[model samples]
Target chain A: MRKQKRGKRTAQEKANARKNITKAIWRHRELYLFMLPAIIVLLIFSYGPMYGLVMAFQDVKIGVPILQNKFVGLRHFNRFFSSMWFGVTVRNTVLISLLMHIVCWPVPLFLALLLHNCVNTKLKKTAQNFSYLPHLLSVVIVVNIVRLLCDGQSGLINILLREFGKDSISFFGDPKWVYPMFVLSGIWQNAGYDAIIYLGALSAVSEELEDAARIDGAGKLKCIWHIQIPCILPTIVILLILNMGQMFVIGADKMLLLQTDLNIARSEIIDTYVYKTGIGGSQYGFASAVGIFQNIINLGLVVLTNRIAKRLTDVSLF
Target chain B: MKRISGERAVNMVIDVLLVLVAIVSIYPIWYVLIASVSSPMEIAAGRVLFWPKGLNLAAYRKLFEMPQIWMGYKNSILYTSGAVLLDLAVMVPCGFAMAQRTLPGRKFLNTMFVITMYFSGGMIPKFLIVNAMGMLNSPLAFIIPGCVNVYNLILLRNYFESSIPESLLDAARVDGASFTRFFAMIALPLATPIIAIIALFSITTHWNAYLGAQLYLYDPKLFTLQQVINNILSRTSSMLREDISIEELTRITLETNLQKYAVVIVACIPLVIAYPFVQRYFVKGVMVGAVKG
Candidate 1:
């Protein structure tokens, strides 16, 4: 590396920085006034709750504020660890995250790539628009559809199963299939819509570059593998890092709707566990502890992934 | 541009696969709408496939009769519009100010914004804060906590930074335009695309959201459409266990399926109407971010 430039600024440069302070203040006061509402809202909703994360370290109750409570360092975390839910919650969170990365993450990319490769523009646009429709459906609505089509009585899939001379699978009732149900539905809902990013990346890759590859005698698969995927790897990495950051955040409402006594074995993940313990169980501190633990891991994963992506690809969230 | 003329066999295979994928992708939605309007007896027999056998608005009529469903609709519209209004008022100027390099306290405030994106206090803490603020059981709980989406803020900030040229600001200043005048006159006009994008997101998000309503509001009447739909779905089975004979109950059960589809269909009508516009702007917004990213 070259020599550092610390303390090396010229007198003119230093003066340039200080020249317009009063002027900038007067010129930008209206802008500052404009932003104050947003700043205050963030301070309240975002930062205030962040300060309330201290409940994780306190013996706190509802109605009573967190600071009013006694400090109980690691008591909740210790209890969480000792409890049986630690294993179940952690296992479910990780399993879902892995399934998302391994199964769902690639789907949009594949769809995007396939669409990008297609010559028919109308078909491509139609498929693209059609794909985002499911995402627009509310989770409740989607889960309702899942219940309908996955029902043992008159589910379309089970009807088809009987026609094919096979057993109709109980998707919601079975513990093993519930996770797949979550992941596959996720893929189904998001793949087409999320593929927009990859399509954007594909569009950004120059037609000239592909032509060059083709002129050099590369086949269709070869062009995609060597050129297209390579061009979009930064985008893929960025998206992957984002997906990884939310590893523990399997959504709560969907799980609650989907959970049966039969499949609670798989659906009782960290979020649901926290919700039940906090609101239903009225163990605020313990719930907060569980929440704080998962979030800390999430924060660490996000930061770690950001750093790795930054180092390897010269792209990062920040 | 030289279009690659791959093998005829390859092209045919790709076309066939694409058609299949599109069908599979849209088939469920098709099924839902068809089943809702289809002959109920035929649906129960699993004979209603690909299209409605006896098309009718009976389920829709039943849905309209339920005053609770209408209340859910009223609540949904109130929340969606209210939240979007608050969101725009907060985010536009906030994002614009953040985009200004010379804005005082920019670095500190930007740090505040970015940190919140990564490390939010968990839901319990958020609930406590909201409870402390007495935003609970009020429309404010839904509207206020989620008013300024940080991700949308980032997108808007990036848009302001890039699309609204520094030269334009300088020209406005030369014309004796104050910062507020410049924003209202110059920036706002150019920022329509960003506004549309964020608006689309806000509408869809607030419309589809159930978890927030679940956490914040307790009153059944205050429940949004998703929560209303959820209650309907969960109750369908229990509703089937009336003391009537098994045959009569089975018929009711099948009718209840139509009810579920009708509720969902009713809830989704706004989305179905708005999605064409949303699809265009949303894709455009993401593409804008992709280029920047």
Candidate 2:
């Protein structure tokens, strides 16, 4: 059997394999040297932490080696599964993320198409500058800006509201207004920046196609619906799939910053919950269990969404 | 008379709407700018609108008076520049090496880099690792743990392969140049565009990061501009929530509305100034990174 397998391999193939293995080493030695420090950094920081994930099953603490702790199977998992905060957190995260993703996804695409057809290039460039400006600011700055503008007493919006004989809205402090503020900030900070990818795709679209549609007696809106939408549909679908992959991955940092005690009911998310329990409370195993649970769900959603997109639109991340 | 086509009419309407949005988009920054110099009493009473009620330098003066803000700026500048250098040092070579088809197991290394982007050990494990290594509370904690972003690495890798011609590399090899010599002398010079783009990204990320400072740094001296801004914002909002009487407003709170706005602007000044310059490169970098990878 071994002789038969060996006989199947041509002499040229054997020699090429040897060359690939042996000659590549000396020739690419410097390349390997270049990659060495980075590889070592990744091994220590990225890969090492992944290995350290095993502490989810162990009752471990910082300053001690993770392996020293006794592994109690499913204990942390059981605590998380039955915890009171679990359902609240998952529901809040899904509700907020789903609403933001669906609502905010198409604004950029719409804006890009509109901007592309705009007659005044100067105005278009000026608008582009304004739109993407917020993307550069950190979440804290954005939230603070929102706070200043939407402040119930001195805020510009409330001042305008009071002028019209309407009650001032408590945007940051009230539980009801939290979601609106979150979604609005999402649109403001991201919509203009997010539109660039679609803009890139849209700018590449052939003018001939649009002209042909117009020649066919189609109006502006009709041409957009028929020609423009379908042309960028693949990019749209691919982006949608990518967005779905991150469905469970809520913004822990932003949420933590935006959370007020008054709006805590609506604000708490899975990532924040984990951060509190794991780092804040020092319940390492419990936090890791929650983190693992979340990551697994995110992975499943991404794979499932990718498969669906592949079937429906013939576009997928993979 | 030239006739206006229905298409032209529709385009006009879209233009009007886009202009309105552009105004809304830019107004937040502009509003804060005018509000920061307005009298505190006017701001607190919701009287300041469209422009400053009275031109005053009190808020900006008060903000500068706080020594902590200066310290925050100093620390942030050091951390941002340091982190940028480290990021470029590690990520560029790694990206170049990973892109080289001549390297053994390039595919495997690429996959290894990409996987980290999707799946990580989450915050706790990473924190534990950082803490165990005694990097907690240290500037190295911020610089070392996140020196290389996998997405940026992948983007750089893609750029290297797509932009750098293979024949140029071959010519260098034909001249009997070692890989390091060729990379340093020729490749590095040609790779300036990507290096600039990555450096900008590194500067933005390191400068803006606050959660790290919140979690890791116990010493007040090590706090970044973002952390100090966060504290200022939180304290101001809580004070606003209390809603003191007009007579008490002057004495009840130390943070004037002008000071609050002034401080926000101060925290954002460095980044805001740099943003427009790099905006074009930023868009290109993001588009390539997003669409391809």
Candidate 3:
């Protein structure tokens, strides 16, 4: 009787384990179905192109197939590293991105806070709508507007300067002003749009906490500083980390639009260099090499920042 | 007491400062509008200040006179409309699908999209794919590849998850409503904010896209407004710098800059007019997706 009971118990346990496995599979089936399209799209568009990164190591000719091209392993990399413009481009890209992060990143946060604090909802909404107007304008249009305003000979800025008996400043042509112009124009174009995210964050701040702070004799600024800023710190940190991760990618389109011969020294980042060399010069191999190099730096930065963020804040982009 | 009055004064000062900053931010665009309407000679001589020196509709007339500009405008409108439609078709359904927690592999799908947000195949690979697809010189080149933006997808997905209650979906299911019926009747209405956000984003992106057109479009007739304006500006600038006659150069430069701004005005005006209607949706949509999520 004991042997028979043991046999039945063992069989039941085996059957139960099999049933559990089946249930687990069933539970996850819908998720897999939902994810399939996105995965397929990513594989085709993103991962499929990853194979072309091999061209960076090749001495590619336009007519010849990519695979048929001669393998000149590290030759492009070596050339790029040794190039005179490499250090300058890297410095310009990093500095400009860093400066933009410092100046542009906070403007939205401040704007959002101010908007949040405003007593009149209508006024806040009006300000937001007006401010966000520039975000929709094309980069080309924005650049043209900038050029119109700052043109030395015919620009509105020079016209204004002349009224004060000052010489017209060649803002676009001068190298010193290029970075500032890029950063400022960037801030103007983006601040309102970015503020939407912060405004979203502010709305999430528990009203009860603000009430408590107020009852505790915390003034508006103190309540905001103590209650509000801390609540949004996670969002800010994540944004900061993400910004750092994208440090290698200065907005190439804007830079290309803004490029002038005089400012080329300061403006030629990796992306613009890739465009000028690869597309303009038809040196696809060299451009691919530069792109791959930038990608590597970007990947490293993202991973590093993500790791640091995870450790410090318990939040990571991943 | 006195401190409260002092704080009010400070607030007033701050408010004025904010208004000044806002004006500064918007001044360049204002300057462009003024310059576009002012006499070219006055613009060149730096005499035109805050307003138009002589309001001229000549630039607008000149732009309209060019058949190329009209063609460009038509192409841009078609491209933007088509792209937005395609983007919406894919994005709306995809977002709805993602909101189903019972759906299999949701986390994995989310991770896949997030990965794409940072890394792309870069331009050459994308070009190669488009070339391989035989989309080169075709409007499909502009439409198909960027059919859905991952950021928009995620945002829309978040909106669906937050705004649409599961009990409502359950009630629909109990009433024998098909998945399509449920999505169409219940989810779609609730998704208006995200739909509007996506529409605005997609329209602006498609309208502003110059690089895609530059890459795949070869036919002059197919050139978008931005491309046409770009060519006009460069050609006119080159003509002016060359040994062209001053009379001809002056005539061309004035016409080109004026028409360029006119093009800008035309491209911007429609969207700017449409923006206010959609702006309310944007804040709510953003809060739902980004903040609450």
Query: What is the DockQ for all candidates, taken in turn?
Result: 0.63, 0.62, 0.44
Stretches of candidate 1 off by over 4 Å are A1-23, B1-6, B239-242
Off by over 4 Å in 2: A1-20, A309-318, B1-5, B236-246, B250-255, B290-293
* Number of the predicted model whose lDDT against the real structure is largest: 1
Candidate with the larger lDDT of 2 and 3: 2
TM-score of chain B of each: 0.93, 0.91, 0.89
Better of 1 and 3 by DockQ: 1
* Candidate 3 residue lDDT tens string, B1-293: 76567557656654665575567666777767776787887777667667889788898887767788778889999999999988887778778888887664567777877887777657666666677778889998878777768888888887888889989887987898866777888899888867988897888888998777887898998898778866665443763457778898777767677766666676667667877787776666566556533
Q: In candidate 3, list every pair of residues with a backbone clash.
A: A30-B103, A30-B104, A31-B103, A31-B104, A31-B105, A32-B104, A32-B105
Residue A205 local lDDT, model 3 = 96
Poorest 10 consecutive residues of model 1 chain B by lDDT? B1-10
Q: What is the Å distance of residue A207 in model 2 from its true position?
A: 1.4
Q: Please state the CAPRI-style docking class of candidate 3.
A: acceptable
RMSD of 3: 4.4
True contacts kept of each: 0.63, 0.60, 0.30
Candidate ranking under DockQ, highest first, comes to 1, 2, 3
Residue-by-residue lDDT tens digits, candidate 2, A1-318:
235567688998888777868887877888888888888888888888775468889888666667888798889988887987878888888889888888778888988987887878988988988889888888889888888788767777887888788998887778888788888888998889889888888877789998997778788888778888888887887888889988878758888887887888888889999889988999988888889888888888887998998899777666
Residue-by-residue lDDT tens digits, candidate 1, B1-293:
23445544555666676787788789988898898898777776668888788887888888878988888889999999999989999999889989987787788888888888888778888887888888888888999988988889989899999898898888888999988888998899999988988988898899889889999999987998888878887774674445789888777877787888777778778888877767788788778777666
